[model samples]
Target: MNTTHTSRHRGNDTGTGATTDRTNPPMTRRLSRLVPALCGLLLVLVGVTACGRTESSGATTTDATTTGSELSYEAVGACKDVFSRTDAPGAQIIVLWDSTASVADMPFPAALAEDLKTASLDDGTLSVIAVDGEAVAPRILAKDVALSTTGERDRPSVAKLAEVIPACVQSVYLNGLVPTAPGTDLHRAMTVAAEIAEPGATVWTVSDMMSTSGQLALSKAVLAEPADQAAETAAADAPVDLHRNVWKVSGMANAATPLLSASREWVRDFTRGLCRGWNASGCKSIELDPVNPVRTATGLPKDPVPPFPAVDAVTTATTCSFTLPDELLFDGGSAELRGDVDEVLNQPLALLDANAETTLRIVGHAASSGAYTAAELLALSKARVQAVRDRIVAAGIEKARVSSRGVGDTEPLAEDIDPSTGLQIPEIAAAERRVELIIEGAPCSR
Candidate 1:
């Protein structure tokens, strides 16, 4: 949910700062009345069936359209939403519980709950772990995740996954008990969570980020602590081994540090450094709040800009948008296009061939995050489109037949989140940061 490192997605190199990925996605998806052939109808239906969402006949609507290798159906999830994507690997999630605290005392943040629901919609499974030091194995909270690979978000089948994920975490917090533990051993518990978290897995930790025992503890000297020395001497039992994966985790990141009472400022500073030390692949934050939660609700920093709640101007066969992640086409913080753009333009090539004379207007988009300001983002989007426009023109298309512009974050680039959970579908938000080609005219040559 953290947008800080959302750029690291889309297979971009880690060394170049967080980039982008097209693998998992989401947006404000809605069923587009999919009406595939009878055979395909049954095949796609499963992907769109609603859980508690209903219709006029009081029966869930059974409508969708399937194309290419695309199958659209709704699955009634605990809480879900519509989405779209190509066939891809499912996601794996590890939910780590800070068993040292009671659910009543250390309540889970509502924002983080939305993050869980957003993630569940992706194709994957959720495993729950209790950090009680009692060595409890991970348990599956949700499995066989349904994805809106087609990029639709409005389908009724979409449950408020945003709610479901956080709820699942709450279940563990409320029901889980620590029979034997010296104190809140956050370091050890986090180590366990880090050990199991794969690079691609999303980790949500519920705790105050405080370590009562084991390795890490409150210390004034901790400020001057070097990564290596801290690891060898004091942090021996701490989670040094899991920094790479931990670098990409989300959820509230603050913990109660009574030691920093002397310097309230150091609490925030030290925690921020610790999160940075993890080199989190997603957003990075070490809050000093009693509950410093760390989840980027559906890949965005909770922004002040109102979400583009309305579904976009519908795409007709002749004029439609093709999404290309800005990071995939260009490097981070810059508009320079990469050399392998031809590969990314496979669909464009086909469209060009059929609509040789039609004009193509590429619109560049950026997500709302700490990455850049609104104006800077708009310029970035515009520049990307201009770069791609140049490419298409060079490829024999008339220079006048193509144009580009940057709409910045003004359009439906990010997904509309459920107000309660503050989570949108992933693909929906990812869809916002892209170069979309708006082609001109009627159905192209077959």
Candidate 2:
């Protein structure tokens, strides 16, 4: 009931805006004023402007206008531009899983969705499709309106933009019930996605890369061209990158066991390879590396680094306890989560689900340091704790099972020091804003 949420505020180096204190009322009020201004300014600077007129060309356009509804025309336009430049026009992501696999066993869809949501684009469109069966024809399980520059960031919009794994549908198909009458045809599925794409679009096939009877068929279809018309077709679509954005997702088999010991390395390698391939293949991939200081030295416009989300460390009993590296936390007095938090929390959540009977309790703590009274610190700490709790629950945990407690300035995980300067050691105050979770009971009966 009583929880302490301690957060620190740090200055933004690029001068976009001051970081808001997570718990301070005045700071919140101040941010309310500044946020609109900042957002407005950002909108103006990056606002979408018509580059060229898109007349109705003979190219078959899949009326993806419906899918763009989730993203603003401006954002969609930007994404389109990025993807187009990367030779990935009208992109599609496919998540394939074994027919016999359980919902919990398949995480590629969720991971793919998260990755797609965060993908940056200057002006192009992206869509995700999932398939599981021998049906030469792959039906669109879910299609979001094509996004552009100007659009609202609503739930439907976000969901449309995000690539959700079709666990529910997959479950149905795996039960010997084929969504398509011909059964799951991976080759045909890829072909359909490629055909529907704007001429010269990127097609990312995310599956276990395991094929049975359909493997050769799919490969031949992907590589095939009409002999007489192949030259003409290639000439017309010459600008389109021939290299398809086919990313195979494997290692679901590894998650079948409890420990996920074999899957861990596979996941890391697969994710890293996927990211690197997407980038190299010119697919407008999200940059995961730390922003290089040297880019600024070259007098290039500094890429706007988005603030990362804050993630609490979860201590699982069976696997190794994973805490986000300190570098992922907000610098001195900041409550904002860093981008690295995504990497830190994503894997843990998958691991937690893999191990049945693992229950988690989230505890929020606030470090009482600098400029605030004890009462103020307590209130702030509680707010911070609640923030973490909310995020966890949103990530699919049952709220009723997970409890939050605020311990104000009680236990210090590290020596109290100024996160920015590292010089001003303030006893043990820096550890206050931490949110800790303890795995308790058994993993919710899935």
Candidate 3:
């Protein structure tokens, strides 16, 4: 969990610590760097599986699920979400902005901002990540991170932050931040998203599905029959985590066309495999009107931009304690276990078993307000921590030995309340909800 940004106008910030190519030539490369920030459903209340979401075209679009180890369309970020008036509670959204040559023209961020502005955000978060062409093959900049969980009282400010979606995307070009590198590190950008993005957040990627990253060029030899480059590349870059209901925008890959279809499958399989490896949930590709790809800085699209991506984590491992985001272990709202939760818990469980002398404390928390009543919220919090304790107990750890408590909205990772109002800062309150395991062992010395 993270705090809200200082300024809501994240689109204007030049960002900190910028590094371009050694040679800054006139009319340099196409684009420079890429940013893919994360946001997700803080709670899995509505369940992503429910279908019939409204699109920008004023038409209903449904997601089609896929089985097997391959990737398939699951959720599409439609125009309706972008144009909607209010956002729901726990509406976490992450954008994989593609400044790649073919995806620069579409205008969808404005719609996303509409969705975010109207969001009844009690503890939800929004992050808009941008990735552009850079000097290095895998040039990625951790800039323009707009994590809005601090609880903003001014709803318009929250929406205004999202309204600059185009500006956030264009800032790279306007500020001359993107590099003129030869290849677009689409693979690396999405790959990084898997590792760092908020787990299970809606991922809206705007790209041409062209993985031109020098690391995995789609040449004849690379895409040969006996060997598949997509899988090979996925294995190389797939993180231990992955994307949420992905909504890909403006990609030219087609299922009907032979060559295009093959390319589409490669990208889809690669993306899905990558997410599956990270143990991420459902995904989908969204289609929008054909917008000309923008190359010049002046040509960047503009819209209501939500908060940008959050800055990287600055952890102080000075103590022997670990705090895991609820998104990592269970769905956003429910205590239902994700397939990898046990796999993730095994390490901690083993540690606990190895050091029986050490005491373990499980604290469950919930972000207040939104659709949930206060009592139900606390119950859910309790259920989450209990679930964790249950897992430990199932693994043979003594139930009595492990102390579990559900502390609802009391302990917050980021400061979400304002002293004057004595109320929650709507922008960042969502960060408060989490489960933390505190380990205390004075006897054992590291």
- Per-model lDDT: 0.46, 0.36, 0.45
Better of 1 and 2 by TM-score: 1
TM-scores of all models?
0.38, 0.26, 0.35
The digit string of per-residue lDDT tens for model 2 on 1-446 reads 22222211111122233332323455334323322222222233334231121111212112212121133333333333222212222233433333322111333344443444443221133444545444344555423222222122232222322221122122222223223332234444544554445443445554332222243221222212221232233223322222445443443223212212222322333333333432224423422221112211122112121112234443333423333322233333444555335455565566455654555555556654556666776665566557656666777776765676666666667756577875424223323455565655433222
Error in Å for residue 446 of model 3 = 82
The digit string of per-residue lDDT tens for model 3 on 164-261 reads 23333333222343434544555556655554454445655555555455443443333421123335455565344454444444443321112322
Q: Lowest summed lDDT over 10 consecutive residues: which window, candidate 3?
A: 30-39
- How displaced is residue 196 in candidate 2, in Å? 58
Superposed on all Cα atoms, the candidates' RMSDs to the truth, in angstroms, are: 24.8, 26.2, 24.8
lDDT score, candidate 1, position 215:
54
What would the per-residue lDDT of candidate 1 be over residues 1-446, giving only the tens digit for each residue?
32211222222112343333332332222232221122123334335333432321233434335443233322222123322221224455566665443221345555455545566454344445555422333332333233322222333333433333343334323343442533444465556566656566766666544434445554323422332343344433344444445332222223232222212333334444555455454434434445343333232111121111111233577775566665356654578877656756656656776776667777787765444678887887788888888888777778777777888888874453446776543445545667777777734333
Cα lDDT of model 2 overall? 0.36
Q: Which candidate leads the pack in TM-score?
A: 1
Model 2 RMSD in angstroms = 26.2
